[model samples]
Target: MDALYVPQGRSRRFVEQATNLHHFRLGIFLEVIDLHLQELDNRFNERNMELLTFMACLSPKGNFSSFDKENILKLASFYPEEFSSVDVMTLELQLDVFMDNMLSDERFCGLQDLNSLSMMLVKTKRHENFPLVYFLIKLMLILLVATTSVERVFSAMTCVKIKLRNSMGDQFMNDCLVTFIEKEVFLQVPDEKIIDHFQNMKTHRMNL
Candidate 1:
């Protein structure tokens, strides 16, 4: 019997190519629009009345279709208190709406501009709102948060499974997992007598 062969569909390949080209065109359009909006934001920054008016309309519940949702989220993360000073609940609901309706195009357009806005919010509010400022002060906090907290939790879970008894009873495994999970909490415990016992054990082991 001769070996059988099949070719991929040419029409499917053509459709994929067309879709990619359309996406590229949209990406270019969003970039050009972003350049113009940036220039507008810069021009309006010093014009306080226009800036505040623009800010207000972009408020969480402002009745405008053109308000940028990404800008509101960026502002909220950076200046939660100030951003909350105005109709906070409305803004929060608006945030929910924007988050739900947010598109890839808006994300691509607003990311850099939002970064700059975040920095400005941090510097401007640092004096009075130190704790909130600390939250927004770092640009890499998003990465930091994901890597340290989330990754570490998963890592600890894996470590517990690997280092402990694989065939142990489930309840015993649960207890071990909890012990590993709250390692930091144990470190913060101020039991001096327990500390002395550990120190003595270490000293005995070293002597051996």
Candidate 2:
């Protein structure tokens, strides 16, 4: 279809006039797909996706079907503070034993996820026996949960520091943010206790 593409609610002078196929292929389809790709790139960039893939290798679902010894070892390398060179070398052997222990043990069979696996290891005291594997599982769980929490804090910051409060000092803003984000804990405290605490900070002639 070579007919001139005139978009609705727009004048030809304001919009570029092109063939129908060319306009749809380049302007509409390509632009929409490019935007979606950009959004995906922003959300799950190369590093994040790679880390997620490594994390998935530790999943216990389907009886630890996703487990990969090499990838798990690579994942350990990411946390050198926790896994030293010696620990990493020993972890390879531990992973094999851990896999055998998990596969042979009926208790570990049919486990749902990393959380359940961690709980089961703690409950059965196997975490002590397989400390390295247990540590990796905990790290994976923490990584996932901490990412969500950090994002949530950023979201909360936007709510706490809106345009009207943009000029708030950093220390005051931080205090306000802590109270706002942890409102549940703050709500439990009595107003009188808060007032008394502030009043007692320094000697005062009068108490309100």
Candidate 3:
């Protein structure tokens, strides 16, 4: 409570008909919260939620069927930049070909995520051919990466440059943060091999 900064207006905010601003009853606060929640409920009512749920069925993670093409059409209808009328018409054939390849090939069928699927496409240099699907997958991947990277950078900054090391230089801090953030990558690096390489680089230093 001592560390908390109370803004002048917010600290003295009155609840309902109460004249005393300092008085904050849990019941009164709950009433205010109830109204706010009611507003949210009205905004995101049943119809909106049902539409969003139907959209979730567009995910290729699960088994995609012929029935889901309508959902795909709906998705393309929303985005005109990537999917044109001609593009939408071609999507059905592209999807059929993509799914058929997946069915015939073991490696393609075994993929569980869009990232892996995209990588396989790039590996075979087939991603450019399926513009809409690949671009959609890539867009989703970029969003996921950008979101996770922000959270990871903050987490890494906390670990790498704490209050004691607050005066750390920008470049130095960035370097340390990068190392701390990519723990999985650093884990693969052998310390003994690194030490040996360092020792090998220094030839003039003798055993004296």
Candidate 4:
């Protein structure tokens, strides 16, 4: 335990001298934690963290233990197009009724998540009764799915546009990206149809 810690692939003179415990605590562990914190900060900035907190209020886990009437109302305010000033006023009342109904309802006792809560509400025909709340839930779910889809597109772009293809034009890159990202849909398109469509675009020396 008293032995000095030597980092691999480097000279001891160029590196800081320290014991294994000190090196692991101050160097490796702290550096890894800082990197993780930086990544989290980048991914969840102020706006995103606010949205996440609001969305968590809508979760039905633990019998809606996380539900917050005020936060949900604030979440509705974020989508002014969906909830007008008048609608927000109505939503406040609706939230109260919705909470009461959900608490008293036996069917809503064990909902695991927002998705299950949404499904249960629709299945039990309670969505009609709590339309505003349901709308908020749907909006949260859509935002979650949209964020994932956008990340997927960015990830696909890295794969589709490699170092060799970096010079591709924006329009061509977008077309290729769309095809690559939605390969399942593109795969359903027959090759003959694609060839005929290209052939009909202009006169060709040979029939493609």
* Candidate closest to the true structure, highest TM-score: 4
> Sorted by lDDT, highest first, which candidate order results?
4, 2, 3, 1
Write down the lDDT of every candidate, Cα atoms only. 0.49, 0.90, 0.67, 0.91
- Per-candidate TM-scores read 0.27, 0.81, 0.44, 0.84
- Given candidate 4, what's the lDDT at residue 92? 94
Q: By TM-score, how accurate is candidate 3?
A: 0.44
Ranking of predictions according to TM-score: 4, 2, 3, 1
- Give candidate 1 regions above 4 Å deviation: 1-67, 70-116, 126-148, 167-208
User: Which prediction has more favorable lDDT, 3 or 4?
Assistant: 4
**Per-prediction RMSD in angstroms?**
16.7, 3.3, 9.7, 2.5
Error of 3 at 207 (Å): 7.6
Lowest lDDT 10-residue stretch of candidate 4: 1-10
Model 3 agreement with the true structure over 133-193: per-residue lDDT tens digits: 6775565567567757887898788888889899999999988988888878988999887
Q: Show model 2 residue runs off by greater than 4 Å.
A: 1-10, 18-33, 190-208
Q: List model 2 lDDT by residue over 6-79, tens digit each.
A: 78887789987789999999988999999999989997998889899988888878988999989989989989
Best model number under lDDT: 4
Error of 2 at 68 (Å): 0.7
Task: Tell me which of candidates 1 and 3 scores higher on TM-score.
Answer: 3
TM-score of 1: 0.27
